[model samples]
Target: MNSTTIITDTHTHLYSEEFAEDRNEMIQRAINAGVSRFFIPAIDSATTQAMYNLEQDFPENIFLMIGLHPTHVKENFEEELNHVTKELARRKFYGIGEIGIDLYWDKTTLDIQKAAFKTQIQLAKHYKLPIVIHCRDAFDEVFEVLESEKSTDLFGIFHCFSGTYEQALQAISYNMKLGIGGVVTFKNGKIDQFLKQIDLCHIVLETDSPYLAPVPFRGKRNESSYIVNVVAKLAEIYGLSEMEISAATTQNSKDVFGI
Candidate 1:
């Protein structure tokens, strides 16, 4: 990788236990590969300290976001939201996110999930921070909440965006930049079919590490270094060079996260 190539991973759970054994090495590999910036998202209170520890370990490279993940929204969700509230009131984070509707895990929590998503969106707006959304098998429900909260101040990345071109337009219409990740490299991942149609300015790169590993590395553990493969895939998709893809997506990430 070119030393001058700058790639920003807009969403990655560097705190994930999947890398617990070799966390430092994993991050170093990413940095060495030109994936120098990592934006970390909060899962819930359980993962807060881990996130802080990650930042402490790589203060300059890691940026944090605090929020209650939709899939983690349980009966005691009020308490979780309160935790998020307290954290936001307490310190600074680059964004509020990994919050959205996830019907793939549990459909029974739809009502609470929607509630949490909307409340967090309000929190993001209040804090004047960008949001990182995690939508899965619930586009309609997620879009419904986003529609209700649409505003000039409402802007963020639709993390791991996996939707149709029309849906891509809809997300962009709401001031969201699509988070393109490993899925784009999948032979059947539909996003690759029309990603070129979407402007580069509306896109950002991610790994969603320890999950959604790109092809050639598919079914294996994902790490930020693999982001180079995603960059290459995008280069192929857009008929550009890897460095060009890296530069554009990194800039788009800065546009969303403001750093």
Candidate 2:
């Protein structure tokens, strides 16, 4: 790994229980592999303290975002949104994120999910912060909200983007950067097929760690260091060097998060 190359995992849950046993060691491994910047996304109020703890432990490397994840939107969603509102009012966050529609898990909450996403987008605009969106099996639904919320202040990453080439362009239309991750390295991960068609500027790197581990590590726990594998895959996809991929995507992340 090139120590000079600074890889950024724009979307990762480092506070996840999966890393409880050796979180420090895991983060050190990622740093040693050149993944020095980590953007942590919130799941809900339940994970707020843990995210704060991660920031306290690694202040320089960890950047936090507060939002209620779509899947976590339920009966008490308004209360969760109130928590996000209060947190934003209380302190600074890099962005308002990990918020969007996830029909893959539940369709009954679509109305509430849309309401939460729109409300958070408003909050992001209010704070002049970018948003990190999570869209799973709900591109149409997600884009519907984005279309309505579209504006100069409406911008952020489409976290773990697994959309088609057209969808990629559509996301870019909304001023969103595509967040490529382990899925690109999957044998059936179709993003690799048309990724080269999209410019490197519209792309950023992520792991969505402890969830979508890349090949060789697939079906296993994912750590930030494994982002080097994603770098290698993007290098192959774009016919560029791994260092070039790292530099470009890291820059793209900074552009979105303003960090």
lDDT of 1: 0.93
Give the candidate number with the greatest lDDT: 2
Deviation in Å, model 2, residue 20 alpha carbon: 1.2
For every model shown, the clashing-pair count is: 0, 0
- Residues 1-259 of candidate 2 have per-residue lDDT tens digits of 5568899999999999999999999999999888999999999999999999999999999999999999999999999999999999999999998999999989999999999999999999999999999999999999999999999999999999999999999999999999999999999889999999999999999999989999889989999999989999999989999999999999999999888
lDDT of each: 0.93, 0.95
What TM-score do all the candidates reach, one by one?
0.99, 0.99
How many clashes show up in model 2?
0
The residue pairs that clash in candidate 2, if any, are none
Error of 1 at 35 (Å): 0.9
Query: Across residues 183-221, which tens digit of lDDT does each residue of candidate 1 receive?
Result: 999988999999999999999999999899999999999
- Pick out the ten consecutive residues of candidate 1 with the lowest summed lDDT: 1-10
